[model samples]
Target: MSKQKKLRKADAATIRRVLALIAPYRLSVAATLVLAAVTVISTLYAPVLTGQGVDLIVGPGDVDFAALITLGVQLLVTILITVTAQWVMNLVNNRITFQVVRDIRVKAFEHMQVLPLSYMDAHRPGDAISRITTDVEQFSDGLLMGFTQLFTGVLTILGTLGIMLVIEWRIALIVVLLTPLSIFVARFIAEHTYSMFKVQSETRAEMTSLVEELVGNEHLVRAFGYESRAEERFEKINLDLQRCGIRAVFYSSISNPATRFVNSLVYAAVGVIGAFLAIGGSITVGGLYAFLNYANQYTKPFNDISSVMTELQNALACAQRVFDLIDEDPIRPDAPDAKVLPHGAGKVEFDHVKFRYVPDVPLIEDMCLKAEPGQRIALVGPTGCGKTTLVNLLMRFYEINGGSLRVDGQPIDTVTRDSLRANFGMVLQETWLKAGTIAENIAYGKPDATREEIIAAAKQARAHSFICRMPNGYDTVISEDGGNISQGQKQLLCIARVMLRRPPILILDEATSSIDTRTEILVQSAFEELMKGRTSFIVAHRLSTIKNADCILVMKAGNIIERGTHEELLARGGFYAQLYQSQFARS
Candidate 1:
């Protein structure tokens, strides 16, 4: 939680941006403010009534019972009206604040969908979650508290000062001069606390990320005997949070006491000044008493407002985090007149393509490939030799740096991304199964898929039999990353999801890695059936599986070194031949 030093930026702009979020609820906000004004006015008049009641009993023998009874009723009525007004204000304020937060959270989630993978790679998932949830919650709470403080603080300070000035401008000058002291004290403390509170917020998000990572892979941590190491890391973070949290709280806590001390001085000076004015024949006894009451009331808003400035700083910091998230660079947008791709023969051709995650370290350069409709293309290479990189280019996950790609003779960049991606179905080595019933997960790609179609796809994936054995069968929920089932079972569910899609182009990258050999045979048979009458790209290390491929691509060091059928490459005695021989030797 160490502080990151930065120059304070302009807050007027940030405040305006936050106020814009509240603009939509102006009607409710206006109504709330009206009620708040009534509450403040009622509260400010109570002190004057007390002065009148005290004046009615000027001396021990000069008491006025009739006037005292009437003043007492007036005081009680004012209190009841203030309470009612405040109650209504709370309801409207809560409604407006909650609605604004709901919109902000929804906007964040929607923006998430359009952001590029590069952005996500740069930030932690838990940090993003904290911004949308915890940060928004903090902002909402701070705003609600600040609402009442804003109305009451301003009105009380101004109203009390006006009354004091009307009674005696000499004492009013002293109160005015002393009031700025409380503001200066508040400003100095708030500035220091701002940095500390900001650090605490960042540290909290980091802690949340660490916890999510550790919990998500608890089995991995235990398997590698890394529990003790994880605990050590968490303890370090926890201690940092404690140090930062204490400093931030301590700094903000002093503002109230420091301002109160200044307020007490103002009170003493006013009391002494009012006594002289009372004795000088310039003010009545009742006027002197009321002036003292107004002086105290004037300073109370100063203290309350200082405390609220602390809340305001926190709210601004949290809001900046959310705005930063919403401000991330989004994915490359479609062409202005981008059109939906027309269904055609799936002929994919890569022409002098170039790509690399890093600018200088080229991973794929001057690559070329051409596949006909219904052809089974297999890409075989050692890990990190650009097999996945090539597939990533085809799916448009990473845009090629230099050259263009075409599908059915149309440049892919000329069409909309949704249309291009909708034409392709993918199943990766890493399986993804969201939380839902088995049927729902399977029908993810094809939302309108029928029950019979789902069962058919599950049967082809060799998952139907096991699914029926579960207590709820296809209706069983796959909770928490599908941890309730076996990894192989999860992989099968992913395959079933893709099978239900039945798109024109298929990309299977190590699609059968986790399955046992017996299950692999069944899954391969299913893939053979699914690949018929479709253009397919297969990335596999198991050379045996690609023996019957229409064409095999042998790649190394970002270039295709060999290309042929299995028997043809074996006869050539090249890289692919050596790779096949090494596998056979090991077996």
Candidate 2:
């Protein structure tokens, strides 16, 4: 309904989720609470002991030496216990806070792995990275502050109030009357600032995403001469973040001073009333002194808590982002009684298959095809003609909207996704190589492959010569995304990875597009060897690449207009022939 109501609901949910994360470490939490209590009790009792010691000295010589000595010893002991408990409590709090944060980050990452590709396509990589990293760090800082400061503040406040009442009800009543002022001030500031802090968190995520996008594509920005425009764009986002941050801090900062001012009034009232009570013999000097100490102690936690509230608000906002990631709906699970696809003949059938990325947009409709065992089915088409989409469907990255896709006569949906995907080796035009040695990259698809196997695969992909030239050869470590190597090298590594797997089916989506013509010919020969007996689905824009394919399906606007051998399609003098002629036509 209202923003306030929404904020309240969100805060409640975040707190509940945070508590759930902490639940597994309940023993540590319980210990922290016990130590907090012990710290507070021992701390509060010291003032009483001090007051007694003060009363013990009527005059310089009128002091009771034996009794004063014992009081002093007891107060010393109480202070030591307070310090020790507080130190141990901090240790437990640190452990619990960090452990919970670690769990949240882990769960968020695990969830991301199972999330559908559509989810990643819909969200920015930078934003997702921010949630698991920057946001989680913020959440950790906030949780730690709450554990270290907020708990102690609350316990101190309650403990002091109880001790104050016992020492002098009249002065304690004054504090009780003024207590609501501090709370109201903190609550008023907190409610207004929570929304601002949430805005700040969102803005921070946007900045993170922008920075990542710009930095990762700096070459493209420079190539387009967009340096000035890129700077302007970045400045705009940074300004928004600055504005949100400033407003959030300005509003949250008000609570501390506002609560401090209220608590000061409470403190002054207690001191004035306590002094009069001592003067009129309504309370002892020692008792009045204890009441004053309790009054100050009681009010100080309000100040500490008010400050902690600002941090908690920011923390809760960040926690909400992380929890959102953790709660995202994962990819649809495999069917009940789903069987693993056994390694059989590579016979794939698409029967009246229908699909679309968006429900309202028609992409592939009533599409049907079949690949007998060991046949190479090349998909040639214009951009957005569903060539790549077709390959994605075969891999089950996206399920067909209608009709059945079968691998060896068994409907693919009936098989576990892992098994179905395991049967196909894929290499796309856009290659991915993790930060590791060249050998490790080649052995990615088959982690248990031996050194000889990795070397053989690399040689097959025409990458072994280049690999051997590197300083460390197979052990040379590559930077992230293989930035240390050429694009062709990265693609070769990817191809080598797939070759190592040697799956029953292959999907090469412009897999050799990055290599030079000479290298392409070599890799093509390798592919010919690799595809000798496997059903291959090749998505290519270059007509020459698929000229020798067993069958070429020429597609346009989401439908296949022609399908036949390359020679047969060309002889038909149809769409396929026109496309082939256009590719090699004289200028």
Candidate 3:
């Protein structure tokens, strides 16, 4: 964990790439562009009409009342037309924006399914969520407000400049000279604002991760008396978030005021130059008035252009984050020609396998194991000796660093992930149930399970009695992670879930380790029934629970030291025997 790499700003190529998402709505985009052009033309007409009104009112001849009324009506008509065109443009722009956001959100989520478990293990849940929600919303605003405004503002600026030249070329030249300076200043502000916004997005994501972790593990914090420590950590992250927010707003707020100041300078220059030209008889007084009106109109589009530039930079920062996630290569699956496991008397073999969660520190090394259908294999090892790691590999949660694992004489890697996982049922030390009825939680794996089948599975796991005793019986709603239930009951519900699945291969990773002695006896009996005809791998520290396993493996460090039946291993007077004596003998 060196500081997570900062995302690059949205460059020209990135903007073009994002715009391509709207390709399917080309018709709507074309309509918007057409309306924008019409709106710009209509907006220019008002200045010309104002100039006509000025000349008529300040007469060198008779004052024409009819001409004044005509100019006034034409100006009113232009305003009405410009407003209508803008309304149409807004509709089209919002439609494209919402559609693109929907597409990107879907693509991001769908791509996540193919990514390996390792990627998820390395990233926080809140960071991933921010990419989907906050990042996508920013993209929407960019598409809608940024894209629409930038396009229309550029067209308006060009159209207004052309009209200004036609009215009085000297004034137009002054405006043109000022254009380059305004653009340069706008670009400078945009660059600074973009950088700050990117930092702010990252800090916000970090803050979200902290909050999600605290809320998800509130029970652990309370149990460990860590509330004060948690609060301190939260305050630190919150302060950092506040600082980033202030910096981003400070940079963004500078663009508008600076653009307005430049526009004011251009307007004052226009008034002075126009007055001189009018007095010198180089231009008509009416022409000078129209030129001034056009100058004011011209500055508006430039102001809008600068604003859109800032928004585009912010949007690009958001898009960069989302694209980074979408570009991650998902774990490669088996080739098309890979072998498929054949139906048989289920057998699992691990040959010379080696693994490490971290490089250079092996958790399991040169390990080999075999179990035929209906065999119960118990793995007995100290806390750090990799019992759960072995089970994880068997379930394909991680790929092995070396060696081979096969099921039914076919390499595990050759089988499709879906097919491989469909053959196993697992129960962990800590059981998890969703916020649903007890029946729904039990029938999760088999969603189409009937009431009779649900009841049967519950009965098999010895959970039916307690479930029946509840107020709602089988329909009792289990709160988040089954919070309404006791630890033993939750384990029983998990047992029922796996039993309902009824896979050929079963794995119990310290499944009985958390239950009381009485509940353990009940669960052990139910487990005995479940293991009758499956190839079962059980990891347990409690020796009594695994005494009847067909093969008992005693492991230390990263290697297995002894392998025998309970009686044979006890008679050998080895580590297994010593561990057994220390526990069962004392009892």
TM-score of each: 0.95, 0.98, 0.92
Candidate 3 per-residue lDDT, tens place, 146-239, comes to 7578778888788889998887888899999997777887888887777777777788788888888989889899999999999999899889
Candidate 1's residue-wise lDDT over 1-587, tens digit each?
22322425534556788899999999998898789789888987898898898889989899999999999999999999999999989988899889989998998999999998778888889999988988899889788878878777888888888888877898999999888899899989878877777788899899989998999889899999999999999999999999998998999899999999999999999888888888898887887788888888889888888889888778877887888889888888888987889666789999998888889897888988999999999999998899988887888877889887999887888888888888888999998888899999999988899999999999999999999998899999988569899989998999999899888889999899988899999999999999998899999999988888999999998999999899999999999989988999775
Best by lDDT: 2
394: Cα error in model 2, Å: 0.9
lDDT of each: 0.88, 0.90, 0.86
Top candidate (TM-score): 2
- The weakest ten consecutive residues by lDDT in model 2 span 163-172
The residue pairs in collision within model 1 are none
Better of 1 and 3 by lDDT: 1
Q: Compare candidates 1 and 2 on lDDT and give the better one.
A: 2
lDDT of 2 at 362: 92
Query: Candidate 2: lDDT of 80?
Result: 93
Per-residue lDDT of model 2, residues 1-587, tens digit only: 98789889999999998988999999998898899999999989998888888889857779898998899889889989999999999999999989998899999999998999989899989889999999999889889988998888899998998877777777788899999999899888888877888888888888889889989888999999999998998899899999999999999888878888897898788878878888899988888888888888898988888888888898999989888888889988999999999877999999999999999999999898999999999998788898988888988888899999999989999999999989999999998999999998899878999999999999999999999999999999999899999999999999999999999999999998999999999999999999998999998888889988999998988898899999999999999888888988887
